[model samples]
Target chain A: MKNPFKFKKEIVNADLFNNDLPLPHSEEYPDEEVIFSVKDFQFYYDNGEKHALKDINLEIFKKKVTAFIGPSGCGKSTLLRCFNRMNDLIDGNKKEGEILYKGTPIDTLNTIQLRSKVGMVFQQPNPFPMSIYNNITYGPKCQGLRNKKSLDKIVYDSLNDVGLYEEVKDQISHSGTSLSGGQQQRLCIARCIAMSPDIILMDEPTSALDPIATLKIEELIRKLKEKYTIIIVTHNMQQAARISDYTAFFML
Target chain B: MEKKNKKINLSYLIERNIKNRKYKDGITNGSTFLFSLLCVVILFLVIGYVLFTGANYLTPGFITSNYSQSSVALRTPKDFVYNENDYDFSDLERFDDTYYSEKWGIGLQYGKDNNQNQVIYLVQMSENSPFHELVRRDDGTNFNIPSDMYLSYITVQTELGTYKTAFSEDGIENMISTLDEAVSIYDSNFLTLGGGISTSLITTCYLILFTLIFSLPLGIGGAIYLGYYAKDNRITRIIRSLVDMSSGIPSIIFGLVGATIFIPFVGSMTGTTGGNIFTGALTMTLILLPTIVKTVEESIKTIPKSMISASLALGASNTETIFKIVLPNSIDGILNAAILGIGRTIGESAALVFALGTFITAAPSFTSGNTTLAVHIWYILAGEYPAYEQACAISIIIFCVVVVLSLSTKLINYLFRRKRER
Candidate 1:
């Protein structure tokens, strides 16, 4: 909800809900449609005892790869999670900022709807303990897609897009975790793609893979760039330079 | 591998290492082995003794038969002969401890009555007498007469004279030989016979079933609240502590609570006066809730946190995630809770003594009070003539049941893990 009223005296944890507070543009970017704009954002952990991120400002261009490369504990992953409100699941989490998704305040959007449009892949390859086909269809089924044909198409297209269909075509019904580490990583990406999200968030997605797996996922990301806007946070400078179109550096 | 091993001089290093710590290693190793062996020996010894003593008595009838019997006075057949010389006790049932006389056509099967009094038990009458009617179970070859009847007196006729002998006299056996020659054949006293664990076993089974019926939902519900939803706060911590503490409380306390609260509550609905199987079950539900909640919560905790995140990220609601993932995954824990309930309920006697009375009924009904297998042990052993053999036999049954439940729990868990892994 966009709140109009604001208290002169700030109440702890309640100040961020004063949604009508305006933010001035501080940085210049190309005239492309800004898919996501972070304005003076601050993130805190341990009930505001530790300031994980402070005064962060950035603008993401449509259908382009934007990488956040920073030292450990600089809250790169925290900011990525904030885009889909994944941080809300954490206990004692507090944030003060304005984040807009396609010019609309992200807080105003339904979380499930917003997350359906903004998919995420974690650092480690964490596929569900289920068949590969079921893993891809899980998101669509959650969105109430009951038709078998549509789900099968989604599964086939998603796996095809991630370059995993050929390798796992014969064993698509095998347990997702039973695949090799890199194959599992690609499978996770395929799972995210099945939801038909507009933007894909990768938080050090290849950190747990070998060199060969890293190269494969990087190539997949470049091909996927034509369809989905990609925002990745990685500590590997070489990975950012090789795969990302624009990069932002952060320091503790 | 051979070249690497040749360079290391493995034998020399091994000899040096062993010599330095040989004394310390030997003492510790010997003590550990001896202690473990001693523990295992003690365990097997106890079990073996129980099995050995109980094996001789563990018959199918002993388990399935009823424990209580009623005695009755029966009359001789209209064509019964008074010939003592034609006495035949070949078909008479035999027991090792009791004495039977073929000439008298009578037997003292189990010497002691319910009152623990040593008395002469009447077994058989004439070949066609109405006093000793037999009805076979499964087969028509054997018969069990209702027993425990007392004989006030008996009139016997011999060559010397006809004399009246009271049952308590020392010369009662001398008079029993002439019992068939008595003036009135219909003046004999009859006895009731019964002793088995079937009723108590049935009661325990009913107790486990009904208690689970009432407890699983509540226990699992509490577990969900504690495992999935509750935050780490003062209130939640207190609630968790209370649940843990409740499991440690003696079941006897729960029995008292049942007697005061649930007994009246159940009695109001049932229209009975005091505690019965239903009330006992209600009390057991209370005793088992904490155990079930803890086991269920622990199982729920075993689920990886990532699965929950994955489910939520897929746009599944919290309730959906819980029902689809957490509950299904935690089934092993739920079954374990039921097994724990059974083992505890079967072995529970102190609490049942209050919730369910010490009375052993032949045909156990939910409306009236009856003892379970455990309470049955307490009943017989608490008496003057303690039936240790029967108690051990009952223990063997309970032990086997517990072992079977434990093995089944393991098998079920293995199957679940296998299915999940596959």
Candidate 2:
């Protein structure tokens, strides 16, 4: 069998940095693979009167759990939104830089297509006002998948992936909003994974949950990296060190 | 002594302030409560008066029969007395009165006038008695006689006997025979005194159906555009304000517009000279548009923006989002709009009178001039002798229909909300 957490050894004994330091020039991995490369990225708000992100350069590895940890107003969430152009929805916000996804410019890809490939889960448990089963199947149905047998398999697989199938198996038809805050957050994660995206962007997915629920989500994140490349923005430094293969600290 | 006196004065002032505030509150609250109670009482009194006056006349016959007035006089020959028994009065012998009148015998005949029309008269057998005329000219011109005329019945008069006569247009026999003949006749004028509102009811139903069909889609579509699609800008603000202002315009103004615009437009298509139900429905569509649009737009605006964002994030198109999420969630508003439209259509008299003329037809067609229930009531009241009884009956029917409609709409809204909650 192959070890899924092979990159854990690189960051286990690493020292936490206190300030914005330049990238190290050491060659740790000779065969390292990069999934996303941000080059000279700059983000502006209020039609360029305010600078939200300035000259950001980062590289995310394939099939690895990468976390962005920073204090409030450090633009961690803003940078995560740029991965799939979710920032385009905001009015009068501007971006000037190239964000490459798998060696292809993200700007070249269609927004709907990019979102389908790189799904997102929000901080708040914003589950749709619908049943659990319907919430899991919403993405597939939007892509025009009509076969019932396949949809049922996808719903079961997605729910089981997030360890929610056991607790909500009998009540899959109940409203998604009826679940507890922790369960709702997991359901949102399950909803994001149901689209079978290559990369999953989670913006503080477990901040609204209890300690036990947070621990469970961290464990799920450690396991999910075997199949998906994960990028998470978190305010908790301990959580960033526990589950992430690589951590980037942003300064305000 | 000074400190004690100050404490007493402070306590007294506080007490007076509380008492004055309570008294003011009581006055305002009591007046508002009394005003609301007065409104309820007035509503009940009006409904009670309508029910009391119209309940007796709202029979099945009144609802089904047509409007008509006919003049027919039938009399029997028992009223006459005669001295002679040997008389050639075989034509009148078959009547019911001939067997009972033993002392009198009657002779009946028809004569031809100058215009070759048959006129009926009676001959008495008693000596020195003048000829009795059953149907005669007011000029008293007796023409030549026709011996082979049809003798249906006869009439006779006597000195000290009561006569048997029948003078009615809506008698039992006449109603059945008229209804039977009405099936074949298309344009027969109603000649009976007692009439019904069957035509007006049918016209009203047609008007309601067409008005709803034409107005709902347009109104709802406009609402969707204004609520979801239009950007918040100067043009949109102006448009919304215009819609709000149009709702306050009097219905009489709409009547004039309908008369000038809709009637002529429909006349060109249906080839009608003046007004019809189609024209009325078209005019009603315009009148109902602003109300439905405003209400449905407001309801759509009340929906949480998160729901819209959720749908959009799922890659659903704007049109799909509107059809699936926004419209389904706002079902209560759509139903409310429909109910209000129905109420307006039912109570609208002035607009329909201009778009659909007030002439009542027994069998009204789509292109025919007709009257609705409100217009019928108006016509009844506008007559020289106001038929308040019939007006009250129609008003009662309208009231019941509007109440039932409003109740059902509320029931539908409740069920929808419950389903959504589940």
Candidate 3:
């Protein structure tokens, strides 16, 4: 007798994968106000010899969390990096496109200044190997704040906004690394907030976290959308649907 | 048939197999132990030999002298009266009078003090005749002769008592000079090799300052370019190869380069025939550059690429990112490199020998010849009379300085690593 519980595994056919799909519109929705506009964007690796991103037109709206969901090797991460010109660091990587930030061409803008304006949180909770206080104040200090009071105020306010202030107030001077996974990610969010940027980019922020921490981050993202224009990249479809106001689905 | 054969052979096979395995293991283990023991023994023997030969020259006087006196004994006719003003035998005492050998410049004379102290004078050699044994005669006459030749000790008159002083082949004059100089200067002070105490202190400080000035920025820049700015390609590969080659280049070659390039350039600028402190510093910079570059590059490479990205994303320019995020984060590594560079510069001898000549005097000038502590040891060892004792003392001095610098750098780096970990 055959077991009723046994199921056959289905093989995904490679030929059925689409080379082209409906390109996302460059215009924002009726209620949406465009924060970033990507016009005819194309990215290539190996000095433009290998195309990573095809001609893509899209609009990212302000003060709402947008999630980029895709399978592995789908160019989702690469597309996210283009917003802040983070791709410049990878040698032999080139892009032919216009990524606009608040109606200003991102390519023409000062890269450093542009990065400051568009803050980023990485997949790994990369809290600098320094004290929590320093991690929070690093961006502000770079922008040239000399007063201790101002720095302290910024740190507390940013930490409070990320909902980490109460838990870490007594140990703000302790290393950011000396925290739980969820707390470290929250601290990273606080650090980004301390910079007071117009937009925040996150790449798989909850991928390395457990279910409980992932839920906490998803909630935090929902709250964060009130103040910042947040873009998140996640392989977890449930997390995108739960936290993001607008979702861009991608496949390879 | 198969079952019967298997059952009978089990015990016999097991015992035989165990015995063979044990024998093989014993041979392998024995050979490994022997090789380790041999290596340790050779290493210990080499260290022991170096210490034994090196420390043999150290004497009480060698520890104190500057080793500046001429190596050869200058002789003249007996009619030429020895100057009394140039002699100092303050530490010696005589208790009795006896007939001393005066013919060979060997004898003793003593003068009594109110404290019941007596000053004893045996045959005393001049600054130019450190190796010459001076024997005093019983009648108060003395003879000075070269130490290689036979000389007889003479009985001398003293207020306390007469005692015979041993004829020593080692000259104590350089030891005296060192004491006199050390009393007035710091042991690490390199600024004044020939000058009295104060000048040597100043000279060492100047040398350190000049070396830091010449090496720090250029080294850091080179490291930054290689570690961060330069794209990894053929050009960078060649530059890296050149840097590695430079680090391995013999200091003597650097010295020649320093002498040929820096010495002439500074000499021309100052209208001097010989290079001064400035030229010496320029020479040392080339010698120390590789150390600083390699150390700093290693340190800067330790920084996380993500941190650099975070900084750049925060609107910091490349320069700002380097100065703000990269440098601050890497200060410990940079400091470690600096300490190593300083130590390398200080211990360097042959290179500076040609670049900064080993002429030391009571008062050193920027335009005049100067000697570093290492160069001083070299000259002391190379002299005709070879004041090996003074060289030993100077080596001890260099060793102490290098140890302190290296230890502090290690400590700082360790602390930083711990802090980063925490």
Residues B342-395 of candidate 3: C-alpha lDDT, one tens digit per residue? 787678778878887777654457886677777776766686887554455456
Q: Please say which candidate is ahead in lDDT: 2 or 3.
A: 2
TM-score of each: 0.77, 0.73, 0.72
Off by over 4 Å in 1: A1-31, B1-38, B71-193, B412-422
Question: Which parts of model 2 have CA positions greater than 4 angstroms off?
Answer: A1-34, A37-60, A68-79, A90-95, A103-108, A210-212, A248-252, B1-13, B65-164, B168-194
Q: DockQ for every model, please.
A: 0.35, 0.21, 0.45
Q: Give lDDT: candidate 1, residue A30.
A: 39
lDDT of each: 0.80, 0.73, 0.69
Give the alpha carbon lDDT tens digit for every residue of B199-235 in model 1. Answer: 8988888889999999999999999999998877777
Q: Comparing candidate 1 with candidate 2, which one achieves the higher lDDT?
A: 1
TM-score for candidate 3: 0.72
**For residue B12, what is the lDDT in candidate 3?**
80
DockQ: the better of candidates 1 and 2 = 1
Q: How good is the docking of model 3, as DockQ?
A: 0.45
Please tell me the TM-score of chain A for candidate 1.
0.89
lDDT order of candidates, best first?
1, 2, 3
Which model scores highest in DockQ?
3
Over the full model, what C-alpha lDDT does candidate 2 score relative to the true structure?
0.73
